[model samples]
Target chain A: MKPTTSDADENSPDLLLFRYVEGDLDAAQVQELEARLASDAALRDELAFWKESFAEPEAYDTAHLEKSLLVPVEPRWTGSYFGTWIFILTLTVTLFRPVPVAMETRPVLIPAPVSTPAVADVVTEARNPEEAITRSRMTRITLPFREKRLPETIEVERNVNESIIPAPIPGIKSRPPEVLSPVAQLPLTGIKVQKVKPKPKPIAVARTLSRRQGRAIMRMKEKARQQRKADQFLKGNVPYVVPLNSENF
Target chain B: MRTFLKAGLVWSGILLSFACYGQVIPLGALPMQYNPAFAGEAGGPRFNFNLGLLTASRFRHNEYNLNTSYDQFIPAIRSGVGFSAGYFTSSFPYSSSSEGYKFSVAVAPKFSLKGKYTISPSLDLTYGSSATSWNPRPGTAKPLNLSGYHLLSRAAVLINSRKWYIGYSVDIPLHNTYQYYRYRLFGRSDISPERFNSYWQFGYTFQRSSESKFSFTPQLVFLTGTDRYNRYSRNSFRYFAPEAFSLNFRYGKFIWGANNAGFHLGMQTERVRVMVSNGFGRRGLVTSDGLGSDAYTGNLSFRYMLKQSRW
Candidate 1:
């Protein structure tokens, strides 16, 4: 069927020609439209008319018009102008008057240590679970006990009538008579412990180690546990900037 | 002749006051105003809105302001982009009113140091316009109106660590249309509205242990400009949990010939923060009667975060 240009529909020749001019028609549509235009003179005239209507007009010179409108207006200083200026002048000075300048001081920067090595790494000794738990529970008390100096030796003055006896100090077993210090002869009762004298014998302090060992272990374990908790926390959270509160002008 | 020169100086000061406020905006409880490098450093895309009201002796002297900002960090490019807008309006006792509008765009790229520290250098381009209307007599016809526009460029660098941050920023006016207006008014051809302003800020955080749910931060900021110098300090405390409360105290010195102090209290959740702040200070009155009058401001801010930061 031949479609007439006067047929008013969505796909009319006029609409197609308009779309074609706007480059909105697909390739097949373009081909069909072009074939129609080639076969019909009236359609060709309509297409040409559309083209002429859509084309942009050529530019022309407007120098004379610009020249006529470019005149500069002279400012006139009248009584009202003077009055306004004086008022503005008064207002500006009154509103923004100067004040005394304060002294300027710089802020002090306090630098923190990057790392602390003494407490960074703590080691715990191997022990039974019960012992470890006990050690961990004993917080700050056990640390200072091991740090203080214990007596190295005791001098016993002999009671001639008394028999030699073992010392009563805990964790220090009785030493043989031959093992006693050369400066002192052993008396069994009312033994007076004198100042800690330097001796070649080293077993006295070692004997007391068994009693202090448990406390030392507990202190280290507690420290190690705290360090572990800190490590876990740091691993999960990374620090970021915290902004300041907003202010008014 | 002396009267004219003094008038010119006073006019410059008045305009400079507005310019200073417009350029160095402290909005939304963030450092993005002074240092663009701080944009999106909080680890996610975020939006903020704030409204403020200022009260003084007279109704005409009161001021109102609205501020909003949005920023996002793009991990793919290791950079951030931000946009901020603000409006401010105030009236003078003498039948005159002034209004200002400001908009800015900022960009910053993050550089990592040792996987624990970050250094970001940023730049911002801002456009600002202010208009003023003067009517010598109220209810009069044909009031005079004057408006001007300006372009400003800012550069800033921030050094951020796990527990500390330091930043510095400088603002330079690129183009000012008010210089021509000033010349036209006073016949002074050599006037330029170019004032150099800079900010230096440092902050530190204190947390006893990771297990502890409380943290404290103290920050100090200093502002130096051609016509003014200001120093302020802010301390903030936050409780970490599903829901938390924050308290902040602030004090500033030499803010327009007045000592200023304020406080902000807020309740926050994982994704939203709402805060109310109040500031009170004394300002030299406009009448220049050598007497100071008290000024107060109340503000509210709402901020939302798209994602939670690791901190």
Candidate 2:
């Protein structure tokens, strides 16, 4: 078998040894280098020295870096922070809040007035015949008195057709106006029937058309009038005033 | 599961605190709903995409909605054309589900006034379809399905000045297959499902000076119809530079009874604008399950302006 003497190994065996230590050599180069190493002890020693000097450093501690990446920084409770928390709290409370109960009450019915026998009817019946006859003749005949009674407990539907009259405000005093003796009758001698003239009907200022259309028509008329004036002036129909003073020119 | 959900919510809250800026884009923000004349108001071809999520405490069901639009102005004709599409789906666990899809096209022509103001009048045509499916037990009879189709036309007018804008729009249903079918099926046409809807929008911007970069805008919108009523208002503060940052407070009642009040943060650059908002309100998506239950709503929107030549 031919020795593996590539160009690089022939010029520099140390380079080949370096490649061998770094595991950069192919299988053939490795076999050649190993064979040479077995023959020369000095080459083996040089290879061992290279391996020891070029060895990679041991792994370093990364506890600080891991902490920096994983841990969260504590924030100071500034005003803005406080406000944010407060808003969050309010929102959470609102979101999870219970349904509100409506404030309502049943209507309370007032007790009807206590029932009592009518004394007037009994007195009228008990009157003497003569006095009754006189009273009957002098007074108009009236129907027997009947009182309509409301139920003791009338159930009124709350919030439906219920009238709530506010209490009258306090501190008001009423003063009746003083009546002056009727004014003396106006003297007829001075009263005269004057011929009254009918007031003229108001000028029809109300527009019959929309304000915008009316304004547009007015603008067109004004423009035509102004054009007419300009034309007249240009045709010398209007006289130019002579200057009262030379300096006024 | 409840504890985990609460924790997740708390985490989201914390993240939102860091963001500190967001804005809500109700239906009023959509050109199709508010004013079709708003299409291509930015003067360049633009695309908009939006995502909305509705979740409640008992997370058995969640509702999701998606919307996107494309629009551009043609300088030669002094007119703008816009097209928008939207889809939303909601489900009730193991029982029923409903979904809807809508597509719309709008045309608006611009007219200049006094060399400083713009008057735009637009018309929009829409085709919408909705389907609902009910699931029954294995041994029960066949499932029932209800589907409907509708066509709507909207006319809108907008007046825009340097710092002020006002618009009004009205929606009319041209055709409704559902109502006709329902009338035929049930033998009565008394229960109509569609009615005339009108919208009004007004806004004014306040700035320190013409050259200043900071501005405040207060906007109001009212939507009235025979079937529903909605009121939306927003107060926004914006700081403009190469990039613009804005903060807005919004309060509104959306269709189907979704009422919300929340804060919004937004950022806008030349080509892109992003907005996100979170609010707590009653989710009206599934009224039966969402009623009286607290809900959290989050909306994210993106606007991209494309080069005119590319379009």
Candidate 3:
């Protein structure tokens, strides 16, 4: 039989190899191509490169092709190494990090009582029983509380003669005593009393003043007291108070 | 039997680590969930629609996702533009049910590396919202609804050849906020939490055939976040650091034609950890140490594409 080199002679070596692998060449052409492939080093390398680079088209029909070709190559350095290191570092830092547990320090404020002149003016302006009650409510006394354990004794100072008394009868307009003595007095330990100007007339004589004038005087006294307290608190000199239980005493 | 035993051991270790770690937010049907650069790299169809079903083993959760993507290559700039919209719903056996929707747009510009590889860089902006329903406590008959919005920005790089591709991406949370009605014994009030989250991922894809190809992709992702709970309440200022590591595998097939169909299967495992600190804005409280949970999930999806051009 004549050697059928006619088809193989027209094609390049690469094409010839592809045709041979695809089973498109006749028997004589296949033999011729195989002989050349065996003798040619470059041709062998080219064929090997193609085989490694491309898969047969028929292989696409098989689902298992990925098992051979598509499986990801093992990385030289796996991500798990870095991940584990990070995980360890994070856990260590979070678990061992220092945290503060104590309460923060805050400034405390204590307001001083109203001045003697202001108190006298407020008392004189109260004209009737109703006016006295209203004016008393307007006088604000702020006690600064501290977040600490309280002591047995709380030091509160007062004038011994200036006692809290109910308003006199509406029609009794006599000039009452400037200072009414307290019915009972707690024992004074280190209390200090500073002498000042005399107080105004008591609630009985103040009842003769007009109600509108009493209201105006009451508002002025309240505003002055609030301004003084705010200034003292801002200066950080206000006294701090601790709540005391009567049983502790 | 030896292979089975080895696999079993590996899975057990993963589960143990995950259980001891923190909570993980699931990535439903977004390819950007793996790497943002994958946005328009395939470049086959003008419109693609996908539907997926997923199940998680940790909380006995079932989830469904529907997504639609549109991608077009602009010859003038040698770039691609992609837009994707997705909806996701998840239900847990006894805990909560959540529904969310997301929309994102990406611009990808392509460059050739040494004429042998194609490199594409992409930026994606995403907006999403989620609502969760929590079962009523002991005395209440109505469920509580919590809703939140998230804005995310992502940058990614992808390098590809005919047979293989590799990508890396970073996602940053631009804004995240959540609000819910919190009921107390005496009254009900609104609570809004401030959230910050970011993550980075690296992925590799290998293809088996030239035409009608089958591919496998594996991804490694790292996530970190600081989530502040009950931000507006006094004596309730608490913040936690959440960190997670995830491994994901995907197998997909692409059928080439005017009307193309794609099928995918995915498996994922994650370990999360949360470290909580109390009294961030108050006094006399310390940070609390906490543990996390492990989760495993599987997903199956199908995609149909309508091609408008042969590019």
Candidate with top TM-score is: 1
Error of 1 at B151 (Å): 0.9
lDDT of each residue in B1-311, candidate 2, tens digit only:
95585455445644553332112344333544568887656556778886666655464455667789988777678777899998887776666678899999998887754334568899999998888676665337555677898888889988875456788888777887865665555544322443346777766655433223444555556655553111121332222111111223221111111222244445443455455555653322212323334565666656677852210
Ranking by lDDT: 1, 2, 3
What range of 10 consecutive residues in model 3 chain A has the weakest lDDT sum?
A: A240-249
iRMS values for every prediction: 9.1, 24.1, 37.6
**Winner by TM-score between candidate 3 and candidate 1:** 1
- When only chain A is evaluated, what TM-score does every model earn? 0.23, 0.26, 0.19
Candidate 2 local accuracy as lDDT?
0.56
Residue-level lDDT of model 2, residues A36-76, one tens digit each, is 98999999898887666532222222345457767777987
Residue pairs with backbone overlap in model 1: none
Predicted candidate 1 versus true structure: per-residue lDDT over B74-107, tens digit per residue: 7677777889998988776678788998999988
Sorted into a CAPRI-style docking class, model 3 comes out as incorrect
All DockQ scores: 0.03, 0.00, 0.00
Q: What is the TM-score ranking, best to worst? A: 1, 2, 3
Candidate 2 scores a C-alpha RMSD against the true structure in Å of: 57.6
lDDT of 3 by residue, A131-187 (tens): 543343344444444343324444578666554555687988845455434533443
Model 2 per-residue lDDT at B132: 69
The whole-model lDDT of each prediction reads: 0.57, 0.56, 0.47
Q: Which residue segments of model 3 deviate by more than 4 Å?
A: A1-249, B1-29, B46-48, B54-61, B92-95, B136-141, B179-298, B304-311
Q: What is the lDDT of residue A117 in candidate 2?
A: 26
